[model samples]
Target: MTEKLFSPYQFKSLQLQNRVVMAPMCQYSVTAKDGIPNDWHQVHYVSRAVGGTGLIIIEMTDVEPDGRITDQDLGIWSDDHIPAFAKLVDGMHAHGSKVAIQIAHAGRKAQDASQPVAPSVVTFPGEAYKEPRALTTEEVVAMVHKFAAGVRRAVQAGVDAIELHGAHGYLIHQFHSPLMNHREDVYGQELSRFGVDVIHAVKKEMPADMPLIMRISAIEYADGGYDIDHTLQVARAYQEAGVDIFHISSGGEGPSGQRKPGNYPGYQVPFARRFREELHVPVIAVGMLEDAALAQAVIGNEDADLVAIGRGMLRDPYWANHAALELGVSKEHAAIAEQYSRGY
Candidate 1:
């Protein structure tokens, strides 16, 4: 049978040469602390593009300076940041890869922010984490605009798609989490309200044909954290608000309790499968799926529409190319860069 992992996939205007995605992993390499993409990021991502990855989701890029987890994290808060991002986007496109930016706010996870903010006054459990100040109702409204502005900048930078960081205890995740949000307002009453609003706002900034992807944690590992049932309800609201794809991930909220996250390959595939089945949308499954055959199995088994490789890609920029070789994809479909043809 033809390897599904090597097959092309498309959603809206974004088309991928294969079903492999380089998952958005924070680089934390912005030395200037100004949220600009530097040479380090350029080479890091472009190398993967050359390596034949179908879709490259740029790292967790913040909407504001203080919204970053650290000063080193990338940000798209300013129009000035567009040129640098556009350069990266252009580089990726030149190599036959479609690019997406994961727009996010670290919220209470902003370790360097003197006053990190969240849905309520809850503090993320960590020595480096601070007690986050609760955003006033007005600030919440403005925050949605900030998210939209970030998406606008990303669109201007020529990203093929947009992934709102709603997972891993980020700002959007904090708002939707019952444990993190304990306010008496509408946002607290309606957990998915904040995410839904951000989706609506960002959707307005995006081209009508551009797909809006939302990464969500299917289940939180923290004690008293939510389960898949609650997240499915939240995702339903996001879908209604206009999320075209769901990237299912898990557990960045806090420390694990009795329900610990699995530490094996394909462990999270079930969650991705569940989300796809329930939401009836294309979903990206991400975890420890580095093995070529395993990655191929994910697509062949219809467990996920796409598989995102994080640590695997970090370890090998040419992971997709190598995986293609391992899976015996034909040269015509393998997409190996001509410059590296001899090596392959």
Candidate 2:
């Protein structure tokens, strides 16, 4: 039987060596204090490439300094950041892996900002979080432009794709999640408009064939979080606004709730399947899907087009390589490095 997990797949202009994707994980190792890629970022991502991650999505990189979740997070707001990212992109490509960056704005979640901003004057529920001031209609439009600027820099840095961080109660999520957004303006009247506007603005800077991926919280696990149907409606709107693929995750809109899912392997696979079926678009499944057999089953059954390894990849930089061997697939398929081939 063909091992679908290791099979190559193409979308738009990207061709992956396998179905393994290193889901964006924050390193927070920006000791340089400028948010530029240092040796740490270079070694961190390229090691995953060497470890056989077909695609590596960098952590939530902010478009502005205040947009960062923390001052230590990566940023692409300046032209100087391009050269560092370009170097990282080159290293990943050298190892035959496509790379992407998750452009984001933390909004009220910008814990490092003296004053965080959101669509409304809501504060994230926690002692660490402070109340955020609401953005004016004019500022909302400007935020869209900030995202567009990030897109331009990422493309200039030669990334394989771009994934907007629209989930996890970030700025985009803050604009859409009714639990946080309480504006009476057009942004509030239409929940998905901010996301659509950002998508449209970002698309203007992208090449015709370059794909745009969106990471969305398909179902909120909070008490008043949006349900599957409502999330699906938002996903369809994003699809219409030119999102090429959906990376499905849940929660982060609010604190945990009665509906919060238990921590289990492949617990979020059903959400990916639902989005793929209902939206008729490709979806990437994430969350606790670290088991080789479970990930294989997800792909073999066509539950998702791609599987993102979060903690698994952290535990083993060669998680994909290990999965290839454990699944009894060929070592060549794993693209094991010549130096590491003996281990395989």
Candidate 3:
């Protein structure tokens, strides 16, 4: 029987062979403090691509230096960074695994001691972030350009897709989540408009064939975090704004303990499914979607269209192939680099 995990998912341009997607993870490796792609990134992503994962979403890349979360985050605000990303793309494509890049700005979550900016003057629980200087209307408009340019760099690097980082209290998240965005401007009043503008603007620069995914933490995971009900509305708005897949994540800002009770495998699937049922668009269910059976159930039950794996993929890169075996089907590690194969 062809299991749910083995089924194909069709985005705008590429066809993903399996419902399993490698979640974009921050490895905290950066070279020259420019957020440029380095060797660490090359091996990290290519390893997973070759390990039989379906599509790999690269880590959160800074659109500008001030948007960085730390000294080690990847960046794509310039043309120089594209060359390195292109190499990473070549390796990923060699393994037959499609790739996506998550472009972001850290908002108030920028590097320690450096003045970080956000829609409001907020601070993460215990992270080292400088007091942010709120952006003027002109600066806000400039941020859009920076974000759009990141898409161009990713496209030049030959990636198949691009996911805007709108979760976890980053720049977009700051705008989307009311708990963080305390501004009184047009950007602040419209919950949907905060992220929609950038997503829509980015579409212009991104490859037409490339699918654009909006990765959002459906719930802000804080006491006064963005409301889930409102987020559902935001989900619909993004679809209208030209998003291809809704990658649902949860919690990053405010108090983490205030999050909804459950976080087990497939726990977050319902949120993704709800968006899918309501919006009728592709949704990638993320967070703790580890086990093969759990992942299978989410897709089999029509709970979500895709399962995104983070720690699980790190725990075992050959998860997709193994999952295929358990589900009584066939999948290959053809994406794995030849050098890493045992019998080479």
lDDT of 3 by residue, 42-116 (tens): 888888877777899999998887787787788888898989999999998888788889988888888642788
Separate clash counts for every candidate: 0, 0, 3
Better of 1 and 2 by TM-score: 1
- Compared to the true structure, candidate 3 yields what TM-score? 0.93
Worst 10 residues of 3 by lDDT: 330-339
> Quick one: ranking by TM-score, best first?
1, 2, 3
Model 1, position 52, has a per-residue lDDT of 97
Q: Rate the local accuracy (lDDT) of all candidates.
A: 0.95, 0.91, 0.81
TM-scores, all candidates, are 0.99, 0.98, 0.93
lDDT of predicted model 1:
0.95
Candidate 3 global CA lDDT score: 0.81
By summed lDDT, the worst window of 10 consecutive residues in model 2 runs over 26-35
lDDT of 2: 0.91
Model 3 lDDT at residue 79: 94
- In terms of TM-score, how similar is model 2 to the real structure? 0.98
lDDT of 2 by residue, 1-344 (tens): 34788988899999999999999988888584777888988888999999998899999999999898888889999988999999999999998899989999999999889999999988898887878999999999999999999999999999999999989999998888889889999999999999999999999999999989999988888887788898888878989999999999988877888897758898899999999898889889999999999999899999999999998898898888889999998766776888888888
Candidate with maximal TM-score: 1
